[model samples]
Target: MKAAQCSDYTSTNTYESVLTVQESVPTPNLEYDTPPAGFKNPMLVRVLSVALAPGDVRVMTGDTRELQGPPSMPYTPGGDVCGVVVEMPKESKKKGGWSFGVGDRIAARFVNKPMGMLGEYALVSPDVCDKVPESISNDAAAALVSSAAVAVIISDYIKEGDRVLIYGAGGGVGSHLCQAVRLKGASYVVGVGKDAKRLKSKPISCDESVNYTKDDAFNNKEWQDKPFDVVVDLVGGIWPKLVDQNQSEKSIVKSANQGGRYLTTTPDSAIFQGRSVWQILRVFLFPALWRATYTRIGFSRSYRPQYSYVIGLPSTSDIVTRTLSLAEEGKLIPCIDDSGPFPFTTEGVRDAFRLQASRHAKGKIIIKVSEK
Candidate 1:
């Protein structure tokens, strides 16, 4: 078990390190009793890896510590992982739970501590594990899970002939969201971002692009007349004071707020009152944000599922079969930014984090946690 370990912050130049993994690395046992937690999951590679999430960072926001410690300590940040299931909870035999077993190569999102896809071996609940779609490679599988889901979730309200716009439409999630909108056949797809470097690499159905760096972007001649029907805001910034209620019909804000300073998603209301636009705010933390709240706002007719959980995880079999078929067709293009050989062995993890933190680097970043 050769894994990278982030011992401290000073010596971070070494992005490559070797680790000795025991046959049984200490894993958090989540069984109710000793009913049958499971066996050791292993990686037969001297490795490192992590999924690139520009939004998520390894922070000590609330009672944080190193990955290894009490259950309450910060978990590793292995959000989007594509790895083999070497073992599973014995309780997996229970009826109507996650259908996973040993050796099933799967892709999933995890949050607890911050082992983010860089750990060679990880202990993940089956709920987070979905069988890798036959359509994507292991690396692509690891890269696209979180970003792809972001695309899928935002495109839910789309209609066949609707016009769509994606802000920050060049990053991983914004890029994929644009592609998904194209796949579903939106009438027009517009992409806006800070520059072209990010836009050049993304595979999107963008009919137009607007670079909002010209001092007053919103008041520009191009944007003044070309208002969109649906705007997908992926960057956290000061929202517009008012959006035309009549012109821009709907919107989805998919980025995380940069804390209290940025009054993100606040103007969704004025969309109707000021701009005559029917705005829809779609955040990824949970669907609960949209529900009863939307009903209270009196847009119940626009919301879907009638109740919540309507857009739950799709069938694993379906995701695997369909995505694999799409992959074969070459319809999916995941922009890859970085791949690593890591545990950060003091220097390894910090360097990886530094690269990941850069505002550049389009597509995804991955570390080779296990040999494919």
Candidate 2:
């Protein structure tokens, strides 16, 4: 099988040297006996399409090796995949517990693995897999698997008539998140990103778009009066920036209504640069500690919104099914980057990673691995 392999976490300029398209990578075998205790046995899939994620770039650059443990050399990197099941576990066929069979089109997000869904063939567990609807294209399905699952989880936090604010609102998860909050009946949605035009366009359609390059929406007077009820920060560094030495009260905290929920997907701005245990702990604990103690113990009664670092977990099959149904109904749009889905070649994959690393991609950067 042909697969894109990374030789090492080297400099981005040397991607051509570090990354290669190999012709004879061995196919993964299914373990019927050792199928992770309760999980179903793995299925061999014929890759159709794959989506590039921030994590892919992080891993390629050796940014997350300390936290996630380094991958073995010459590993394939991709998790969001849309593919067809070429072979199934014998037990799955005999027990009849599997929802899908050989030849079924599926989308899956493989977790905690080095050899991921970026090859001509890959093995996937059923737990994180979902059947892709006929209405959804392979590229779109690949794009949606991980990001949309996270968006759906985030949407659960939204309440009817709540005012929502999203940081990094033009990327993959951010785009899906924008639509997810709207679907959950948010009264208003404000999106902050570099690309204001795309954030306010169709699919994402944020009620208001803030270009972070031109303006500071957090400190702006315009949003001072209209505080948000829910703030989802996909980009880090905002929380620390919220504190102003000049102001008695943190003005950025004032951007959110009292008791508003502030959820962040990353611990800090250095997430991709490499995070120390202390740095990670500070980002995770500071807000919680402040909310729990500082507000109550201090002379001032002013309170910042509740803060949390949210990690997107592997979604259940039910959530995946619902997400696909929503996409099928045209209620949830899988936002692919305007420049992609890139072709599945060595150079094509390299370019896709370059776009993803640039952080300017309008939405999900997709790689078309094979024809549908």
Candidate 3:
């Protein structure tokens, strides 16, 4: 089978040196590598389309080398896939399962690991795989899995009439987060990002948009009267502290009302893609130091908002299913970047990764894995 394999650690975050097309990459056959002991057994899925996300980019670029370690040489590099079930063993059918079967169009995101979805065949289990609706395009289904799932999680924390602030609101997860929050009945949704035009281009349902490049991104007097009920920090680390690292950036966090929640999808070095070893270490260690510093400095932390990390849900199937249902109902839309879908060829995958690493994609990057 043909697969876009990561030949080695990417020299830079762009994945130019690491990703290459290779034939003869062994395809997964349920006969050899069965699903886990108790995971409803195995189902063989023929890759159709795949989506690019920051997590996939980080893995290829060695940003996660210290934590996830490097994939063995020639490892396939992808996380989200939309595919068709080519083979389903009778034993694979659990008595009270989702009834997944051959020919079912499925969308799944591989759990964080070296496991790849770029290959021709992917071994999927009931836990992470969800049957995508006929109304959803394969490209959209592939793009919806990971980011939409995170958006679902973030929305769960918001309540009706809540004033929500979504940082990085123009990117994949941020775009979905805006829509999800609106669906959750947020009274007002403010999207903050570097590109106001891109934010306005997507139907993200944000009530207002803030361009961080401007002098008063979120600190303007216009925002002073309206405090946020929830702050979703999709862009974390020093980004929140960029305008002013010495003290907490009021624009990023201080706007949150007391007792409100502050959520971040990225909580560690995960967001720092091959930037520098020192930078990665600082991010990994800063959380602890930040907590201690707050206590030692005797800083009045009474008004500190609840800080939490949006670790992906244990079972992504639920969110994936809900996202697809919303898509099928036309209540939600998958935000595929304007750059459009990349071909399934090796050069296509490489180019997609380069665009993703650039951190400026207006929406999800879709890879056309196979034709309908």
Report the number of the highest-lDDT candidate: 2
lDDT tens string, model 3, 1-372?
A: 988888777747666666787788888777776432223465778989888888777766666675554435667777778999998755734456674668899988766453467878877665677888888889889878867777877888888988887878988889888888888899988888877766666578577788877855456555545556777777766334522522543443342235456677775334564356676547654674574345234433444555556665665367788888888888778988878799878788888888888887877888887887
lDDT of each: 0.47, 0.76, 0.72
Candidate 1 global CA lDDT score = 0.47
lDDT of residue 5 for candidate 1 = 38
lDDT of 2 by residue, 1-372 (tens): 888888888655348888777889877667532321123567788999998887878777775566643436777788778999998765553334767778999988856542367889887777677889888999989878868878888888888988888998998889999999989999989999998988888989998899998988776665665667777888777766655421553354332235566777776573545457665456566655664354344443355665656775753566677788889999999999878988878898888988988877888999998996
Q: Deviation in angstroms for 172 in model 2?
A: 0.6
Candidate 1 lDDT over residue span 188-256, tens digit each: 777676655456444654776667675433444554455444555566432442223223532232111
Off by over 4 Å in 1: 4-49, 54-75, 93-100, 111-117, 195-202, 214-217, 241-329, 338-348
Candidate 2 deviant stretches above 4 angstroms? 31-40, 66-71, 92-96, 245-257, 273-301
lDDT for residue 368 in candidate 1, whole number 0-100: 52
